[model samples]
Target: MKASNGTTQDVGGRRKNSKREDESGRLGEYGQDSSVNGTKQIGATSADSSGENIIRTSVTWDGRSDAGKILEEVLLLKQQFLDYVKSHQGRLEARLDESKKQEQKFLANAEGLELRLRKALTIQQTKDESDNTEEPE
Candidate 1:
């Protein structure tokens, strides 16, 4: 690793005398690209290639004009989904309350009808008994 001043600089215990060569044998830094189709590959080396270790990394996209707009659109979509779920849950709760009220009303009406039927049956039975007693026996 020779510097332009014709001297070798000790950098991180590695002697760098010439221009740094990338994995593709192209001269560039970590994030720089020497061509349009090739990428600066940054991934697991041979030390951690198997399933024994976990490597954590994050990807940084090259700057584009519509990145913010795309992110905003995604957030808006998530909000819309949340809004729909909230409205639907409210309507469902209303329906549940209405159904409960209707069931209670139906039960009340049935109880009233049963009481009236019991009273009518008692009166009819008493009249029949009186008519039989007033007969010859």
Candidate 2:
């Protein structure tokens, strides 16, 4: 049996390893160098999260193997994603504030218009009553 390098040979010198690559880095024994590989894998999820696979990898603080380097890249990507989410949240809050301001202004204008209309109606009614009370010649 060949190693898990995704390669296999047959009797006729033919490669018969037809399998899709597992992106989860499932290269058999991974905890062989936990002490010397000062690394960690951190992941968080939410209620609406999908995908049961654990997003994990080994991160090397000082010096590690190729797998450690790959894990480091993953950590960097996670940080970048968090930064992007924070930035988006800030923008959304700003937009919400602007919308509230606009709504308040519209309500104030509407109230002023309503007051003016009520005053005009009251004046018109007073004029009509005075005309009816005047004595005719």
Q: Please, what is the whole-model Cα lDDT of each candidate in the order they appear?
A: 0.79, 0.75
TM-score of 2: 0.49
Which ranges in model 2 have alpha carbons more than 4 Å from their true place? Answer: 1-65, 135-137
Residue 49 deviation, candidate 1, in Å?
A: 29
Give per-residue lDDT, candidate 2, residue 59: 36
119 Cα displacement, candidate 2 (Å) = 0.7
Ten consecutive residues with minimal summed lDDT in candidate 2? 53-62
Please give, for residues 17-53, the per-residue lDDT of candidate 2 as tens digits. 8675655567545433333356643335364345555
For candidate 1, the per-residue lDDT at 8 reads: 79
lDDT of 1 by residue, 1-137 (tens): 54757787765654667664576656436764345457545457674366543433223455655788879999999999999999999999999999999999999999999999999999999999999999994
